[model samples]
Target: MNVAWYIWLWSDGSALQLQQPIVSTTRCDRPIEAVTAVTGGFEVRAFLFQSDQDNCGGGGVVPISYVAGVRDGWPVRVRPTYGPLATCDPQSLIVPLRPGGVVQLRVDTDDRAPIVEPAQKYDSLLVSELAVSPYLPEEQRGDWVLARAARGKELICGYVRMDQIL
Candidate 1:
């Protein structure tokens, strides 16, 4: 619930216009980069660089998008969701990712370490500390991973954590 409320009613009905800040962007320069060699229908969540300080013309920002809810609610009739992934709550603005989809990523261990910020929440961040495992193993554990992307609107980037897909 970072702030994604689109409940309006103020034209002569009183008050109900939320924060009004919905941003699900894609400019490129960092975060969202996973390409272990995926290309059978599309599965490359983010990569764009016109100059990573000076890299120049190197692009790729695929199937990765974020936002949680928007199908037909008001905000003028918002509609941007393809569904393959797109979690909710951290504000809302999801779309894209429907090329060969498979997404289920959310891990929150204990003790500490689990704060990844790329677009305020997470588009990619697993750190790989041995595949992660430490949610209060004895009392002080840690691990973290949670970008956005539910399914059909595709927003969250790279994240596996379903016991690492078994």
Candidate 2:
């Protein structure tokens, strides 16, 4: 079995952006609630895409997580996946958003896995949809000018070396 995983960030109701080339990694067993504080009354979503194959068969899975804040802004949510190494194709993950909030996505892999390609050894992390307005009509029901400012998208990306494991 082989699989590739990545993270995405969506904000301000614009389009879901990709956050690749992750620069850091952290482990948290709790739901992310901090994001609500940052977005006011926006929504957050996370997803995992997986595929596998046994000597006699094949299988795959795509799991999605969505959390909505009651008022505005919630907390950061973190989850983990368990399985064998899988190959990730280019543009395997996609995120959706409206447009004045910020969203960040990241991907990590087990360092113990044997490298099929040296270039693939690097884990890609991307950060997108930073500081914008929601693309939703309700989000823009108020002041029109302010609404336009809120409806934009921003993104970032980086990488984490295996030797820097914490």
Best of the candidates, lDDT: 1
lDDT of 2 by residue, 33-151 (tens): 22232342223332333333221221213323333222112121222222111212223322232322232212223233222222321222221222122454444333211001111
Root-mean-square deviation of each candidate, in angstroms? 14.3, 19.8
Q: In model 1, where is the ten-residue run with the lowest total lDDT?
A: 70-79
TM-score for all models, in order of appearance:
0.22, 0.18
lDDT score, candidate 1: 0.31
lDDT of 2 at 98: 38
Model 2 poorest 10 in a row by lDDT: 143-152
Residue 95 displacement (Å), model 2: 27
Best by TM-score: 1
Model 1 clash number: 20
